[model samples]
Target: MAKSPIVFAMANPNPEIRPEQCDGLAAVMATGRSDYPNQINNVLAFPGIFRGALDAHATDITEGMKLAAAIAIAESVSDADLKPEFVVPSVFDRTIVERVAPAVAAAAIKDGVIRKR
Candidate 1:
């Protein structure tokens, strides 16, 4: 068995398969629609990434910063609260940007691409 596969149907407007079809099957289900849980939108990371880069005065956006932002986003969902429906934090979560910003800033500093200390 695949051991409960992760599925990202993530099409705009309509997903490849509705989450309802996967009930009791998928380990994680994601789509681009706001109506569904774990909506896989780029907004989950971009704004915070830009904010962190600007805040850090980064001369260049490096892979490290992106990786850090991804980690922050993933960690935003606490292990205790994690569920198939909540693999990613809600986009409206105020802490999303806060968590991503500092992580990205730290990565920028560590990567030595920041224009200022």
Candidate 2:
């Protein structure tokens, strides 16, 4: 039998499936709504992404920059702290901007997309 799969049914105003319905079937669940435990919000990334772009004077956001931002976000959650209900860091986590911005900026510089460092 397939084990519980991580589900991210992030539909605005209404998620495809409520966290409660998953019960024991889902290993982890996320939604666009803040009422849920794991709320997958775009705010987590955009701030840092823009900050990095501005800091690096990026010409345009590239795939490498996006990947670096993703990696930074993933690294924000330590292995010991990772859990089904805590796959993503809190939206209010102060360190997110600190971590993601530099990572994205560095990636932009590395990918030769930055107009100025």
Candidate 3:
């Protein structure tokens, strides 16, 4: 039997939106990709990053500041190496969580979100 495909949907709950008006959400769906994409959810990112931070004894995580961290991770994969189906590196990629955590931690410091070391 073939495996069913998974599509990621980015839904925003807003009473003023359309198509599922009663649901009050605008959905931006990812038609073909992993079970989830970055825009759809942070499921791909948080766990490993947290593990790395904990391993490194981090105090906090931040908001927009983390964008730099993600960029660093994404950039580690060259644009020539990227395809729509593979924008993010696999969680199993040994360098990924290790490379990303420092940037996130630094971002937290820069954003004033980390009150401690």
The candidate scoring highest on TM-score is: 2
When 1 and 2 are scored with lDDT, the better candidate is: 1
The residue pairs found clashing in candidate 3 are none
RMSD values for the candidates in order, in angstroms, are 1.7, 1.5, 9.6
Worst 10 residues of 3 by lDDT: 14-23
Question: lDDT of all predictions, in order shown?
Answer: 0.91, 0.90, 0.52
Query: What would you estimate as the lDDT of candidate 2?
Result: 0.90
> What are the per-residue Cα lDDT tens digits for candidate 3 across 1-79?
1233233434544212222231223223242233443332364467546764554455665555467567766776677
- Which candidate, 1 or 3, would have the higher lDDT against the true structure? 1
> By how many angstroms RMSD does model 1 differ from the true structure?
1.7
* Ranked by lDDT, top first: 1, 2, 3
lDDT of 3: 0.52
Candidate 1 C-alpha lDDT tens digits along 6-73: 99998889898999988888899899999999988999899899999999899999999999999999
**Model 2 lDDT tens row, 1-117:** 158888999888989888888989999988988888888898999999999989999999999988998999999999999999899899999899999999999998999988842
